[model samples]
Target: MNRPHYILLPVNPYFITFSLACAFLLNLMPWGRLIGVPDFVALVLLFWNVHQPRKVGMGIAFFLGLLMDVHDASLLGEHALAYTLLSYGAITIHRRVLWMPRGVQVFAVAPLLVVAQLVPFVTRLLMGAAFPGWGYLVHGFVEAALWPLACTLLLMPQRRPANPDDTRPI
Candidate 1:
């Protein structure tokens, strides 16, 4: 299908942007110790990578990760590399993942979340941050826990095209 049809298909770009924004806000929220949640950007980017690969891809993930790196004031390019790999990973498995049930999808995502966290952790370690300790792994767990919630919130009517038949945007 053409690009316009893709835009008008089942996912709206506006909603996608909003969803990512919300995830970003949530990530930015002051949660103290509870902030150990996995990377929200990874979750949202993976979802869109599978559901709407053409719209959300590695570039967005990289840019967002860079922004997050700046916000977190951590090593440069650490999260960027992680997100870039994550985006590619999601795209690689998008088709297979789409065919799985919701529960199975959740199971599938757990590892991705784990690996996503591991990548940055290892990167930081390489950059001379000392071992971040197991506490760092907690974010992966929290991220897994939050996946369903993220999916539920982002998988809203606003994100999906209003009309299934109107495959071309007005």
Candidate 2:
């Protein structure tokens, strides 16, 4: 049986930057305390780190984390450290993670997301901040659950239609 081939379009750096900025903005929106909202910035960072490691890595993560710190009014450097670690994890497993199907990728990313959440939690605890309660962890799970959606959305711009008339190799 023959299989159809698809081409992946080149990704624009500006698009990546724009998407990250949008995620940061989404994270800053007030969604109330009752619902567990996923960390949009972190999710976008992780997605880019995995799919475009050369373009988005630890530096972006750190900078975004600092932005998050300022926006949320949380302990300084707390999110920076978490995002740096999260970037490391994503870069480390990017090759392997990308080989998996979308559903399995969620499982692969869950631990990294947990680590991103844990660093801030631990930092706050050490700084004498009271435990924010188990509810905090719910966001990480929500982020993990939304991984597939994020991946699909981000990849949309890079997906190219296969042309039957074109003879280029896939």
Candidate 3:
């Protein structure tokens, strides 16, 4: 059972920005308050961080975080802080992560997502907010579960065609 190996082309910077924007908009949907709703921004940010650390770094994460923070109307830096840390973690493991199959990568990325989400939770608690309950933790795993699907969709633009012609060599 060999999966097709794709030689990915260089990613477009514009595409990266577009995907991040889409992810941010996804998060802005009204379903966010529900338990176990995956954080699309975190997932996409981590995806790029894992795949292209040079092109997408913590600075971008910070900017996206600030935007999300404003939209959520929580602590000004809550999302920013979590996203930056998440970017750092992803960049740290990017090399190793790229070598993994999609299934294995899910496990590798799950802990980072969990910790990233935990940052805001802890921050809110420290700032005198009431406990949000244990369900909040499930969102991380939910994001993790979306890893394979995200990888397929996000990498689509960069993937070389399955049938390559002589002139279209990857």
Q: How many backbone overlaps does candidate 3 show?
A: 0
lDDT of 1 at 38: 60
Candidate 2's TM-score: 0.90
Name the candidate, 2 or 3, with the larger lDDT value.
Answer: 3
Give candidate 2 misplaced runs (Cα > 4 Å).
1-5, 32-35, 162-170
Give RMSD (Å) of candidate 2 vs. truth: 2.8
Q: Per model, how many backbone clashes are there? A: 1, 0, 0
Name every residue pair that clashes in candidate 1.
38-143
Predicted candidate 3 versus true structure: per-residue lDDT over 19-103, tens digit per residue: 9999998998987679878999999999999999999999999999999999999999999999999999999999999888889
Candidate 3 colliding pairs: none
- The digit string of per-residue lDDT tens for model 1 on 52-152 reads 88999899999988988887888878888888888888888989886676667877777777888889888888878878687887776777677777667
lDDT per model vs. reference = 0.77, 0.87, 0.93
Pairs that clash in candidate 2 = none
Ranking by TM-score: 3, 2, 1
Top model number, lDDT: 3
